[model samples]
Target: MIISTRRIKQWLTFLILFVLFTLLLYQVMSFFTDMFEPDSIYKEPIGDAVKVFSDYGRQTSQATFSELVRERLLWFYEIGE
Candidate 1:
């Protein structure tokens, strides 16, 4: 039997809807996983700001501007590590 255009369109629609639904489900699962996972880096920032800079040796005033900025970001990342 020859497949009709309507039959092909129906199957294609089903496929797209299935893919979209699966993607949404996966995203939701990931969101929950990240939210509840221990040691997840998506945590609130802590520690003193000045301490973070000093810990990076920025208190010496010898670090360049770019180096200081990079170190500051590194400090933020280190909090959750």
Candidate 2:
């Protein structure tokens, strides 16, 4: 039940190379899969992966971009009713 030093070195090298090869294969496969993904990928951007920016502060009143522009325009016009 005794192993030779050369045999142990061979097994170690094999294990290391096997692990590296598996990692390489996984990366190649994932690259291909991502390349072939549907264009609708962006349609689900706010999915479970990222939900922070989509639903921001709730307690504070926030004016949208168009509303802010309109308010600025009215202020500049000085329309008093």
Per-candidate TM equals 0.47, 0.48
**Best-matching candidate per lDDT:** 1
**Per-residue lDDT for 1-81 in model 2, tens only?**
897999999999999999999999999999999999987856765546745333323425577766766876797789662
Best model per TM-score: 2
- Model 1: number of backbone collisions: 0
Q: What TM-score does model 2 achieve against the real structure?
A: 0.48
